[model samples]
Target: MLTRSFPRLATLRYPLVLAVALMATACGKGTESTAPAASTPAASTAATPTDTAATPAAATAPAQTRQPGPIVPPQGPAPVLGTDYEEIPGGQPWQPEPGKVEVVEVFGYICPACAAFAPTVEPWHMKLPADVNFHYVAAPFGPEWIPYAKAYYASEQLGLVDKTHMALIDAIHVKKTLPGEGDPVNEQKIADFYGQYGANPKQFLDMMQSFAVSTKINQGRQFMQKSGVTGTPTIIIDGKYRITGGKSYQDVLRIADHLIAMERAAMAGTPAAAPAAAPAAPATGTGG
Candidate 1:
């Protein structure tokens, strides 16, 4: 089993405060204004300005695009409504399914807090029950962050996410092979990274600038706007509850588990369980 220590909580109220503070650093370190959505002017419509000069020529086309198969999640204790998660009025799943409980994490590749939360959540996701569906919606918090988000959708289109998701995170944070927050972004470099995992660099770059990728990016932005997500590493439970408080990464998972259990019970027409002990630990760090 994965192991982590829960810091002693000094006060229940501080986690939200600390979460807010940490989320501020999740994204938007770049000096430019946030990119416009697809509805905006054409000048700003591309996910990122295509850097043709930066991309290396490709000898092969990208593999055919494919839809991703489903994945799963797990359960935990009863959680507090406002403290552990906040309800979104008229909220809907990012992608609704009839029988599965969906858990979506809104994250940015360059967000430090997201980088920190990734390892903890990666293994946690693998253990989820077969009925649960886990998804990721990449957040392009600034102009510099857009290329990474586009690369994400392109990877999804090419069915490379299952292999390269974690590696891409490492590319930005650990390996320093790709640009992060302040460094100049090269779409070619981003596409070239996927090339290592069998994606054709040219086709990947082309897909990154494709209409489908732009639509997905805009869709994600609208979902984040609708869900009130403003930072990286934020979890949405069945598109209803926005995870807003957790003293640590473990606490976040605990609350998610609790909520998942609640969702499961609701699906079966049974009452939810009594509240578990609320997480009592200092906020570990920021998410974005």
Candidate 2:
């Protein structure tokens, strides 16, 4: 099980405050990926520029995204510690089981960046090597974001995340069902969206509020805080490294794949693949 930091009451309130500022700062982080880009939801639009040069050709034209890319070996200098990637302070990656490396994505349905990053993450996650274990941790940034996280956790309990993951994003970003801001989340409407996926509205709604799901949400919040994740779409590798190359959404995965290779080798007792030295302090930068 994952560990939590905040007390129950305070944890519930923190997301409301942090979410407000996060949207503003996050605007400066990544590209907004949507059709007829001008109409992109305000929250999902890219507010600032990142290193799009690192965005490979496949990401530029997602039509070819499913084509498997070459599996480059992890060589050359390691990613600059404390810069490219930051280590969690005295923390271990939250692995689900032995024989697999943990990959947790911190995202929010309301985050435009997360919506934009979804396309890249969706196909990429499926192609991951067998030794890597991937996870999605929804950010409970506010009243709007909290409902999505609750829904995601509910899906997790029902073994339906794969079924609902991209569909939720499409409903909001593509169909424009969910508002970007200025309106409270409509639970019934969101429930209706899930209903189409065969989730009984009552059962799904009840699952979201179940004690078990609540605990997972709390644990996710604590994990974000510990790992220096300040926005949607941040990635934590093996609970130790936060991919911070800040190149592009695609670069996030590129760096993560490299880290996975390194971790994989280390697990094999390869002395040449020593882990990066621990950082003196945990990163204070946002995961944007």
Candidate 3:
């Protein structure tokens, strides 16, 4: 059965079950309460079915919020518009920017899926052309994840994401240090984790609580709210397409590459590839 209810744990987002259950909750860490949609699939019966079960037709069906698709690897064609990806109606209405396609990822430090996804997307991101600008926006789901969000903003302010992004994920998901067992949020340990990257533990700690850090965190939360994302590691391409390709994280990147091509084609005034039939409405949990 399709599970749409958010889990009660701190770690938000579902496992990559067939790529659908992504937004359905209790992910690896599991749990978070709703602030509100501020915006933001279909019910698939095959709990363990193929990843593409949420095809065009099913996508038109009204689904409960947070319905998680399955976690199967993506073994399909490049994502279909209005099905695999949801176009941000009204044109990324959130922020107005110029040039350079934007690829934004809504993620959390406590999300194991995000941790696993980092390796998959990072290498691909490095290869993208200058027209694409990629970055991450930490999701402030709850207390446990908010601190990590703070850390992310501070690190970004310090210009250290490339330097310590992997290390931080490794520290939490692998090294198993960095505090926060259940709902615990520890800044000291997180600061210590960044020490190896030339961050002064004291300055890092202070930065985590600084006004500038708070401002960035707030901005990130608003952006996430505007993003209509309820799951971690959601890849949004050029602010129009959200790469929720079913199957593998690699498929997400593959779809991203294809979409990037489409964007480039559009920019050049060339006729774009045929789009998948538009759904009756946008698919929220469906995409992420």
User: What are the per-model C-alpha RMSD values against the true structure?
Assistant: 12.5, 10.8, 11.5
* lDDT for each residue of candidate 2 in 30-135, tens digit (9 for 90 to 100): 1232212111122322223253222212222322222434446754456656556777885666546787888988877765556556667778877777777788
Give the deviation of candidate 1 from the true structure as CA RMSD: 12.5
The superposed Cα distance between candidate 3 and the true structure at residue 275, in angstroms, equals 1.8
- Candidate 2 at 54: error in angstroms? 13
Structure candidate 1, residue pairs in collision: 9-280, 22-286, 25-288, 26-288, 27-288, 73-128, 73-129
Q: After superposition, how far is residue 150 of candidate 3 from its true place, in Å?
A: 0.7
Runs in model 1 with CA error above 4 Å? 1-32, 37-77, 274-288
Worst 10 residues of 3 by lDDT: 1-10
| TM-score for all models, in order of appearance | 0.73, 0.71, 0.71
Clashes of 3: 19
Q: Give per-residue CA lDDT, model 3, range 151-210, as digits (tens).
A: 998888887887777667666655667643254677888898888778998999999989
List per-prediction Cα lDDT, in the order shown.
0.65, 0.60, 0.59
**Model 1 CA lDDT for position 279:** 62
